[model samples]
Target: MRNLAEKPYVREEQREVQTVRRQIRKTFTRAEKGLLTLIGAAIVFSAILMVSNYASMYTQNQEISQLQNDISQQQQYNEGLEHQVSELSDPERILNIAEENGMELNEDNVRVLQP
Candidate 1:
């Protein structure tokens, strides 16, 4: 059987221990708090870096797409100019234009140069 005289003393000691345990459980250690703060800061920094890189990549892709469109337009314009050049340089077209202007081609007036 337990000692009846020590029962109240043991109950008081148990209440004090429970109070200390509750206080300890309610507060974080300083090192643990610092570590948690550092982890949160790292997560925020990583998110910022990821967003910045994504924006940079998106801008570059848009520029590249615009440049490709410019190249396609320039190529089409160059092809049109090539067709005009071929038409303007045609011998039959040149002869018709000269005839309209009252110009004649004489075999005796033609001189050939050898390279």
Candidate 2:
């Protein structure tokens, strides 16, 4: 009965020693803390890089959209100018303008060009 009582005390002491060892193991070393801090900083830098890249892409897209709109407007204005040119270049209108300027049409000197 006395030996059995001593065994329980010994077991309790062993348990306390193991608990203390586990606590000690849970604490971080200096090198491990530095490694963790480096990894955290790297993660933050990568996140900032991604956000900046996205912002740059967004700004470029807006510029491209604006350039496309300007090109479309210029194309429409060019089409309008082409239509006006065609109206002004009618053969009948040219003949009337020549007559109004006191010019005579001689068929012998007239040249008809085909496109």
Candidate 3:
């Protein structure tokens, strides 16, 4: 029919007009292009900063963990040395050693020194 042919032609013309409108909308002005470029750069810079901060934090945490382990090992070693010192300085052990060396305990000859 004649109307059916005209309908197809009208739809084609409408489609062409919409395509031209979309192309015009897609075109950006100089100022808009500059603003978009600045926004993209800012996003990239922020991402870089975030990654750098995370790396720094991770490194610091690892250092702290290693230091804690070192401190724990040092404390354990110090405690062991302190126990040995206490055992060596026992009064009974000192008396036995003095007897073995033929030294007698003389309270009157002992002098107390104060710091």
Top-scoring candidate (lDDT): 3
TM-score of 3: 0.75
The predictions' CA RMSDs to the true structure, in order, are 9.7, 8.0, 8.8
Q: Sort by TM-score, best first.
A: 3, 2, 1
lDDT against the true structure, per candidate, is 0.91, 0.91, 0.92
Q: What does candidate 3's lDDT look like per residue over 15-91, in tens digits?
A: 44343444445689999999999999999999999999999999999999999999999999999999999999998
Q: Give the alpha carbon lDDT tens digit for every residue of 13-34 in model 1.
A: 4444343444445688999999
TM-score of 1: 0.67
Kindly list the per-residue Cα lDDT of model 2 for residues 1-115, writing each as its tens digit. Answer: 4675454543334434343434445789999999999999999999999999999999999999999999999999999999999999998999999999999999999888999
Error (Å) of candidate 2 at residue 103 is 1.2
Relative to the unseen true structure, what is the C-alpha lDDT of residue 66 in candidate 3, on a scale of 0 to 100? 100
Please identify model 1 stretches exceeding 4 Å from their true place.
Answer: 1-27, 108-115
- Per-model tally of clashing residue pairs: 0, 0, 0
